[model samples]
Target: MELTYLRTFREVAKWGSFTKAAETLGYAQSSITTQIQKLEEAYGAVLLERYGRKMVLTMAGEALLQYANYICRLHDESKEVVAKQSKGTLSIGTIETLASFYLPAYLQAYRKAYPDVNVAIQPGNEPFIIDAVKEGALDIGIILDPPFSDPELDCSILREEPLVIIVSPDHPLAGQGEIGVEDLENESLILTEDGCTYRAMLLKVLKSNQVTFKLSYEFGSLEAIKQCVTYGLGIALLPRIAVTEEVMAGKLAAIPFIHPECKFYTQLICAKKKWKSKAYVGFLELLSGGAREGDSDAGSELSK
Candidate 1:
């Protein structure tokens, strides 16, 4: 059977939707259908069945998927090993805050080191990123969350990320030496989207303390939350890295808010069995060691 057909089959099985697989693989819906048809023909079995709105794999399809995963991975590995080439695609899954604030320098360094290697960054929530990494859809997953581990992943804590409460410079609590959950009582809070880890931590802290707070604004964009805070619409909790420049510019003030329960870190995760292509290893080194090999200054500032 063709490797491309197996890959298409895997993608279709991964999402359980032909349309979604087509989108992810950048193929027309009809192309995805044709590829699956060819794969089923090659195997001489009905590989997929429609149930309600989803495309579900049949017993034979499930068996084929297992071999496809191994075969596809080994095929890629063999190409790299035989060619010894640095040119390949690397897919990374990350959260918005890290993608916007933290990853630029490292990505730049990686690009410089491996100009021929294509890199794709997909922004997603932590759970989604983790799942993509586990499914071999993404080569790496970066997230800001509490210490995390999975038996199937090689997890590393890249750095401690401080979660800070931000407000307009003139807000009443802006000048406080320290602020706690009780300080936010009855105060309006601007929050990020529901799946954000820090947002969950803030909600838990508030509810656990029985602090009555109003959610004045809820946004999916970090910049939107920052803008709302700057206009004094309400206070917001976010990673210090996300607002460092604004705080330094006096556009926003970071209240001295520290809660043990609210601690988060920049984490790097990858599947334990993932093949380490040259580009993949270079990027991983850049993330974990703060610099790619032979480049001393790249990403050094981020380490500090």
Candidate 2:
């Protein structure tokens, strides 16, 4: 009967971990367990069963999930109507690369324009970001090109650029006007985490070109990757947008990596069924419209 119980059940079922669901919902682990117990008590049926490290839903739980989804969606839509007309909170998910170097200006401008609508952001990798958007946990998402298509989502390409190889100004590769994929063989590389889309593509290209490589470091943060490359720790391949400021500052040099398969794109994605609050619409307008009014200087710098 309680919508809170259904929301907690949905999260726990999706993640299959009480601890993870608790952290995401800002509840204690015990609270999640208690909510689940309450749901089972109210339904008069066994719902969740544990099998080793995994949680498996019983038949009754599976049947209830269908109704729970409908209930939660209606619950959200009802709240949307009761909140200030056309105003509510919007949560956006993105990768660290964009958050740290790219979206700060646009987000700040959005806050100024929509004072009544609170905006928040959560960061994760590409796939995680997309999954959050699909589940309605996030209202919008910015991510790399999704690996596949789904009818439940809508997405658009916001920007596209060549993937570039970057290194310290004094590094040997920095002098080359452009580097072939083979030239990177045996080079120490700094890259994002192992499963990142760009990192995986880079390694695949190297493998196809018969280049053996070693990872000097693997980082989850773009800033850390830049710091390592700035000191000659290792070279990296990243989207030009992520490293433009450092490249301009002469802290690092960006060179075209000539491979037929190397390209990067930033995509804006949203669930087809998500409620579009005025805040969400206004923020997208500012972001896709061009740099904000006062961002002329920053925009001009990045245009190079």
**Deviation of model 2 at 48, angstroms:** 60
Sequence-dependent TM-score of model 2: 0.66
In order, what is each prediction's RMSD in angstroms? Answer: 17.6, 18.5
Candidate 1 structure quality by residue, lDDT tens digits, 1-304: 7799999999999999999999999999999999999988888999999999999999999999999999999998978754654677899899998898788888777777788888899999988999999999999999888999999999998887777889899999998977899999999999999888888989998999999999898999999999989998999998887898998998999975778787688889999998786668778877877723223353556444
Off by over 4 Å in 2: 1-87, 146-148, 291-304
Give every collision pair in model 1: none
